[model samples]
Target: MASALPNSLFQQYFNNNDYADIIVELKHPVQDTNCPKSTEYFPMHQIIACSTSTYFKEACFNAETNPIGTKLLFFDISLEAFTIIAAWVYGFRGSSFERLFTEKSIRGVMDFFIDHDLETDIYPEMQELRTLLLKNLFKITTEAEVASATGSPRMDLRSLEDICEYCLPGDRNTIRRLVKQQIPQIKCSAGWLEALAGKSAAGFLASILLEIYQEAQIQ
Candidate 1:
C-alpha cells in the first residue's frame, strides 16, 4: 500500500514550477550531415519525482549514494514522454496518447521503469500508462499504422500475447480487430496458437477463432 500526500501539497508544488530542484534533460544522438543534436529540458521537483518514480528517486536523491549532479541526462527517451511522466509525478494527469505517446516511445519509458525497479505501489500512474498503451495498440488498424505507432513492422508476438492476456476479457471487438490484423502470422505460428490456447479465457479465443472460420466460409 502507498501513503497519500496531501492534495494541497501537490497543488502547491504544481503552482510553483520555478521551485523545481532537479532538471531532466533529454538529448538525441547526433545525426548525419552536421545537424546539431536536439535537447530539451524539464524542470521538476525532486520530492515529487523521487516519491513517484524509482528511477528518479535513485538517480536524483538516493540518501546513501554519491553525488549525481542536479541535471540528469537521458539519451534514449523522448522529451514528450518524459514531460508527461514528470507531470504525472507531480500529481497531474498524464497527456493523451493521441497527442504525444506512441507504442515505441512508451516502450522506452517502460524499459526505464523496469531497469530502475519502479514499483506500481509507488507509481499508480505507471499502471495507467500501461493500460492506455494496450488499448491504443489494440485499436490500431493497419500494417503501416502499426509501423508508425510502434516503429516495428508488426506488433511483436510478446506484445500480442500481452494484449490477449490482459485486454481480451474486457473488449472482445477491439481484440478481434487486433487479432484479425495478425491472422496471417497467427495462421503460420504454432507457438502463437498454443499460447492463446493456454490463456485463462480460452473461451474467448475459441469464439474469435470460430468467427474467423465463419468469415472464411462466407468468403
Candidate 2:
C-alpha cells in the first residue's frame, strides 16, 4: 500500500512576508567595493531561522541571554547574499539562485553557515548549499580572466585546509586546479605550507603536494 506524505505546515507560511516575526538587517562594509555600504532589511520567520541555524536558534530561543528582540544586525555581509540565505531559510528556492550564486555571495553564505554550525550531519540543506557553492567557486577558479577581473579574494591557508577537508575524495579536479593556480603564491610562504601540513589530512595533503610538485616539474 502506498503511504501518504505528511503535511508541511510551514510550507503554507513560506514566502508570507506578512507573517514574519523577525527582521534581519544586513550591512556591507565600506571596504568592499563589490557592494555598497548600506543596510537592507529582510523579513523572516523566527522558527525557520532558529530551526535551521544553531546561532539563530540560540539567539531567538534564548532571548534572555542573547536579547535579539525581533531585530538582528549582521555586519560585512552583502544584502544580496543575506537575502538569498533568508529566502533559503524559508524554503524559497527560486530563480534567485542564479542571481545570488556568485563567488562573493557564496563566501558570505558559507561564512554564515560556518558561524551557525550548519554541518552536513546536522543540516542537510547546508550541505546541499555547500555543494552548490563549491560548484560556483570551481567555475570561478577555472576562469583565470574572470577570477582576476572580479578581484576574487585569495583563499587563506585555513580556508584551503577547510576546502581540502570538504572536497577531498569527491571533487579532486577542482582541488587540483585550485592548487595549481595558487601554488606559486603559497609556495613563497613557508608559513602557509607549514600550517597546511599541520591541518590537512595525510592523503589530502599528499594530493596537494603532488599537484605542486607536478606544476613545478612542468615549469
Candidate 3:
C-alpha cells in the first residue's frame, strides 16, 4: 500500500472510492434573508469501518490492487448537524450485482437496518438496500449446492424433527452449544429455507419457527 494513499484506504478500496468520491461542500454562502452565514468550511472526511470483521472475506485485501467486487459508496458529512447523508448524485446511484457478493455489503445493510431511523425518509434508503440484496441473491448457487454442503438433500420434515429433538429440555443446552458452534456452519435463514422450497414457504415457516424458538426459551 502506498504511504500517500488516502486514510480511507479500506473504505476507498472496498467501496470503490476511485469511482465513488465523496462530494465535499466547501465554504459557500447560504441564502438567508434574516441571517446570511458566510463561514469558511472545509470538507471533513470521515471513514467508518464495521466493528465486526467476521463476514468479510480475505479476497477483500486485493480490492485495492485488483478489479474484484466492491460497492461504490459515497456520502456527505456535515459537521454542523453531526449527520451523514448519502450523496447519491456523486456516485453510483443504485446497488448492482458487482457490488454485493464479493463484499460484505449485505451484512452491512443488515447492521444498518438494525439502527436505521425509520421515521425519516426510508423509502429511498430501503430501495437501495433491496437492490443490493436482490442482485446478490441472483448470484447465489442452486439449492442443491446447499444440500451438498449439509450432506442432506432438501431439508425434509424428518431432518427438522431430528434437529428439534436435540434442542429440547436437557438436550436443549447441548443443542444451544451446538447451535453456537455451528451457527456459521449451518445456513438456516429465511433465505436458506427459501432456497430449499424454491418458493414463499420459507417466510411462513420462519415466522412460526422463530416464535417456537422464543417460547421454548421462556420456561
Candidate 4:
C-alpha cells in the first residue's frame, strides 16, 4: 500500500492539535473526497491513506482487503513500510537508530518471538500487515526475473516503489492492507525487525499466519 502521507510529514504534524485534527479529517474526509475516481493526487492520497490505515485499519479498510481472502498473502506484506510506520509510532521508546541498533535489544526482541512463537495466536492486525508487504513487493519487483530474484534472503527493499509502479493496479489494495496490519505487532520489538531482515522471515511469518488461521478455524 502506498502511503500518501510520509511518516516524516506526519511526524511534523504530530504535536499540533490542529494538524492532528487535519489528519483525523483526512482519515474520514467527505465522501466525494474519499477515494476519488481520478485525480493527479489520487494515487498519492491513496497510498498515504493506506499507510495511516495501520492505526485505524478496522474503522476504514477492513472490508476492502482481507488477508485470509488472498493467496500468497504474507509474501506481499512489506516489512520496510511497516518498519517506517512502527518507528514513527514507537521510536520514542528507544534511542536514535544508530544508538538503539544494538545486538542486545535486537536479540531480546528475536528471543521474544522465538520463545513466544505466535503459533495459533492471531493478531487483529495481521491482515493489515499482509496488505503493506504486498504493496512493497509489487513496488520493488520489475520483471519476472526480478520477482524471482526477490525470493532470495538478501533482497533489497528500497526498490519497492519501482516494482509497485509496474504491477497491475487491481492488486495494489490487497498488498497495502496486509502490510499495514503487521506493523504494530512487529514494531516495538527491535529484535523482531533485525531477525526479519534476513531471507527466512517472510516464510516464517506466512507459516505463523496460516497456523493462526487454522487454529481459528478449529475454534
Candidate 5:
C-alpha cells in the first residue's frame, strides 16, 4: 500500500491559495434581502478534496461531464459548519475547531444533512447524537402542549431548531395527553449551555428527556 501523506503537507496545501485547484463556496440557506449566511469561499487542492470526499471525487474527476476549469461548488450550509469540516480535512483539528460548532451552528449543519436526506449517511456515533437532538425537540414540544393545557412553564428544552433540523414532527396531541400534570419543573441552572454542548451532561439531559417521554413517570 502507498504511504499516507502527513497532515502538515495538507495544511500547507490548504493555506497556499495560489496552489488551489478547487473552490468550495457556502450558500446561504435563506435569501433574506437584509442578511444571509456567511456564504464563505474556501479554495483547496483537488487531490485533498477527492481523497477525502466521495462527492468531490466524483465531481472533480468527471472531467468529461464536469466543465473544465469550473471549480466552484455551492455548499448550502452554515460557515461555522463548513469551517469545522473543512478544517478537519485540511489538518486543522482539536478543540479550537470544535468550538466553531456552537449550538446554533451545529443545528445549521444538521439542517444541511437533513435537507439532503443524508441522515442515513451519518456515523453510528453521529446517529446517536442526531437521535438525541430529535428527542430533545420532541421532549420540549410535548411539554409545551401539556403546559398549555395545564398552565405550567416549558421544561427541559434542549432546542427546537436543533431537533427540527433532523427529525419530523411528532404527534403533539399524543405526548400532551400522556402527561396531564407537568411534574418536571422549570428550575434555573448554571452552565446549561456548556452542559448541552458536551457528552458530560448527556446523562442528565437524557434523564430529563426520559422523564418527560415516560409521561413524567411520577406519582
Candidate 6:
C-alpha cells in the first residue's frame, strides 16, 4: 500500500508553462469588461487533459484534423465553469473547486457540461459538478424566504429541483440540511409544486417529504 501524493505535486503543473505541453482557451459569449485578464489562458498537460475529456482527447490526439500544438479553444463556456473543470482535471479537491462552485456558476457549469461532450452520463466523477449545483440551489440566501411568506417572492426559482442520481456518502445529508433551511420559503413559492410535479424531481420531492414527515413526527 502507498500513501497518495499531495495534490500540490500535480497542481504545480497546472497552468505552468514549464510542464505544460498543451494550452486551453475558453470563451464565454459575454465577459465583464471589469475583469478581462482573469480568463485569458490555461496551461495543461496533454495526457491529463486528453484522458479526462473526450473533447480534449480529440483536440490533442487527432493529429490529422486538430494536431498537437493547436489552440484548444472552447466557446460558450464561462471562466467559472472552466475553472471547475480545469481544477478537476488537475486533481484539485480543495478551495479552488469549492470556491468556484457557487450559485452563480452552478447553472453555467451544469448547462455547458450537460450539453457538451463531457460524457457525464458515462463517468461518475464529472457528475460532482451536478451535485454541487444541486447543493447550491438549496442554499437559499435570498430575500425570497421572507418575501414569499408575505406573497412577494423575489426569487424566480424554477426548474431547480432536478436532483442528480449520484451521491458521495454524505452528499444527500448536506443537500438535505440546506434544503431544510429553505423549506419554508420553498413551500411558499408558487412554482415549487409545479417544479416538483414531474418524475425528474422525485429525489427533490422525497427530500422535502422526509423533512415534513420528520417535523410532524417531532410535533
Of the candidates shown, which would achieve the greatest lDDT relative to the real structure?
2
Best by TM-score: 6
Query: Which residue pairs collide in model 6, if any?
Result: none
TM-score winner between 3 and 4, please give it: 3
| Model 2, runs deviating above 4 Å | 1-17, 32-38, 47-58, 63-76, 94-96, 144-219
Question: Of the candidates numbered 4 and 5, which has the greater lDDT value?
Answer: 5
Candidate 4: where are CA atoms >4 Å away?
Answer: 13-85, 88-96, 112-219
| Full-model lDDT for every candidate | 0.56, 0.58, 0.33, 0.33, 0.53, 0.56
Whole-model alpha-carbon lDDT for candidate 2: 0.58
TM-score of each: 0.51, 0.54, 0.26, 0.22, 0.52, 0.61
lDDT string, candidate 2, 26-141, tens digits:
67676668876787776667666666655456556654322545645444577767766665555555465456676677777777666656644555556666666776665554
For every model in order, what is the number of clashing pairs? Answer: 0, 0, 0, 40, 0, 0
Residue 11 lDDT in candidate 5: 68
| Candidate 5: pairs in clash | none
lDDT of 6 by residue, 1-219 (tens): 111555567678776777576666666654566654444576777666666555556656643324655445544677776777777766777666577666567666766765765534554456654565566645533443445556633233333343333223346566556555555444433244444545452545555545655565577
Candidate 1 residue pairs in clash (backbone atoms < 3 Å): none
Tell me the alpha-carbon RMSD of every candidate: 7.9, 7.7, 18.4, 20.2, 11.0, 6.5
Q: Regarding lDDT, does 3 or 5 come out ahead?
A: 5
Choose 1 or 3, whichever is better by TM-score: 1
Q: What is the clash count of model 3?
A: 0
Candidate 5 vs. true structure, TM-score = 0.52
